[model samples]
Target: MNKRLLAIIAAIGATTIYGINHTVAKGIMPHYVQPYGFIILRVLGAAILFWLISPLGPKEKIDPKDYLRMIVCAFLGMGLNMLVFFKGLSLSTPINSAVLITTTPIIVLVLSAVILKEKISSRKILGIGIGLFGALGLILYGSEVRQDAPNIPMGNFLIFLNSIFYGSYLVVVKALITKYHPFTFMKWLFSLGVLICLPFGLEEFMQIEWSSLPFEAYRGIAFVILGTTFCTYLFNIFALTQLKASTLSAFVYVQPLVGIGYAIFTGQDNLTLIKIVAACFVLVGVYLASRKPNRFYQKLK
Candidate 1:
């Protein structure tokens, strides 16, 4: 297959995994592993999986200078990013958490402009503004979610913080991945991410009730490992090798639509006119931001 087709396939696969993983994590897995513990295993499992696929040895000669830059990306991207998000997920309702997290793309665009010196077009900026308005509407409606889901406002705050780190991770990935092997970067990134995250997560890991948790908990754990932890990041690195960070991060806006669609399919949420309108705005905004300008638009200018 051509590189473009391969990149599209990878993006779809990654987005599906990420969207479903949120449903599983926020809707299901909190039944067993607390947030921090869950994140630890995610990193640990991903670290092991990447290692099995691409062995990391002390003898590999990645210049410490370059490797260290990637390590900082890991610290911000995987380590602290996961820390804040799972903490938020642990403390609050998934609907609010997921919806608030959608704002990352807006944050990402601003950060990209400032940190990476990527130029933002007027159309993209307007899209981001509209996307934020839609996201806020979701957040307002999301607060009415049934008490079955947790509502830790602290968790919500952390998840937003996670959005920042995640944005930074992408910029760094875009800058570095071309010069290094994607798998090489993945192996070391997760390895260092685990190391950076360990201190915060270790206490929670020790306290988990492994014996009492159901066998199904293990199943959920596996879903997180395969879908959320390993594949999502790897797919990201793979796609970013071909596409820019802005293109990849644009996928963030589509996730809520995915979540809502899944909810409707499972009979968990009723499809409403308001939600349809909200979803359309988000999609329109994302399209304007992520896609290249049309020839007609360029000619008009």
Candidate 2:
């Protein structure tokens, strides 16, 4: 199969895992493992897995200049992205987190325009606006007083912060994706992520009562380490080589669908008409935003 198809599949797979993670991770946090502790587990486990496989890939060395860039990717993608997201998910409903994550594509578009100086067509701008409206609509109407989610507003805000940092990470890492093997970059990126996040997570990590935890909690933790972190990040970084950052980020639109489905399946959330409509807007907006410009428009220009 062509790399493009493979990249598209990778993007979809990564987002699907992330969508499910909203509920799975929520099932374990603030009880079995707090958010910070879970971040530590995710980064550390994924980092080790990347390191273990790095030697199997090409043995190219990273350029010294790119080291700084790698560090920034780690800080934004691995550290800030996961830390805030899990914290927010802990305090927000899975469905709400799912909807807010759909904003990532818009953030990516803005970052791409500003940092990469990528030109945006009027159609894409309209798509971005429509997507933003849907995302904000979800944030406003989706807020609920749940037993597990205590602070919907604050949690949603933090999740939005995560989207910004994650969007910036995609733009920042695009240049480096072609320079090194995915495993090589990931090993270093997550190593730095662990170091940077250690201070905040250590206390929480220490609080885990490993022996007393139930089997289900263990399964949730393992799913986060193996499925959510190791597999998803690897898939996304690999896809970045074959697709534009905006194109890959557009897959975030799938997360809400995936997340809401999982939530509904598990009897954790109820569906609503407003959510259905908001999802429609986001899906249509992402399609328009990620599409290649029309040939007629190019010719007319």
Candidate 3:
């Protein structure tokens, strides 16, 4: 019970931080630079934060195979995934971006089953069907649903790819995490990520025109560092010690509602009858996907 409580608190904290970051980033993205440029900075910021804040401990040795997997994890988790997401966020509205990314859980389910041999259950299929219907409805009904808006469509699609890469990274890392401390795991992940992202980051950095924007534009980068980049994942790390990833997956969806509330607060968006219905569907889906059939439920009298 205590563990569950702690996990809930951590997940809530993570979601709140993530929610705020989305709002913050939405405000700053177009003001400063392009998505690729923002992501280069975001990942580098996370790299620095993880290194400085991470603790030193006795190291656990692992196979070369594990190290290779960590490299792939870095590419998918930090490098490519972030690049796509930030770019997408820059092009699309924050609400649209958030809604698209919610597909991460579904991706995780499919990837885990194929790669990790985890079984797909009936409840997961039903939850996905319900949630996807709601999400897909919104996508189709969005103000500019046509692909003619290249930036918006591109951004939204990239976020979906972001979900896939992120989900796959989780399955990949699950093998190595038990053998390593979180800090140690992060060290390898970030270090490898820095190199993989260098090619893209370098291109972005070179193309940026520092003179075009005032120093204030850099504020978004800092927000990415402190509010969104560092804090949200730290909250997730805290929760991992207490809860199963499945439970935490459901909690991740809470960020969408958090995002909707942000939009309302900022006057950027208001809850519509349709969106309310969509939110309810997403909530129910997350609830169903997060839970496994309990032994008590199975053995019901």
In order of appearance, the predictions have TM-scores of 0.80, 0.87, 0.82
TM-score of 2: 0.87
lDDT of model number 2: 0.82
Q: Best to worst by lDDT, what's the order?
A: 2, 3, 1
Model 3 C-alpha lDDT per residue in residues 37-70, reported as the tens digit of each score:
6777777777777777666655655578687787
Model 1 clash pairs are 88-155, 91-152, 92-150, 92-152, 93-150
Listed per model in order, the count of residue pairs whose N, CA or C atoms clash below 3 Å is: 5, 0, 1
How much is 18 displaced in model 1, in angstroms? 0.9
- Which candidate should be chosen as best, given lDDT against the real structure? 2
Taking all chains together, the TM-score of candidate 3 against the true structure is 0.82
Model 1: how far residue 175 lies from native, Å: 3.0
Model 1, 103-154: lDDT tens digits are 6656666676787577788998888778666655554443434454456445
Q: State the lDDT of candidate 2 residue by residue for 1-301, as single tens digits.
A: 9999999999999989989998999888787899999999989998899899998898888899888898899889999998999999898878877887877766777777786577888899998888777777766766676788888778877888898999888778877876777778888888999999899899999999999999999999999999988888778768877887657655766788899999999987777787778777777776677666332221111
Q: Residue 109's C-alpha lDDT in candidate 1? A: 69
Model 3 RMSD to the real structure?
Answer: 4.8
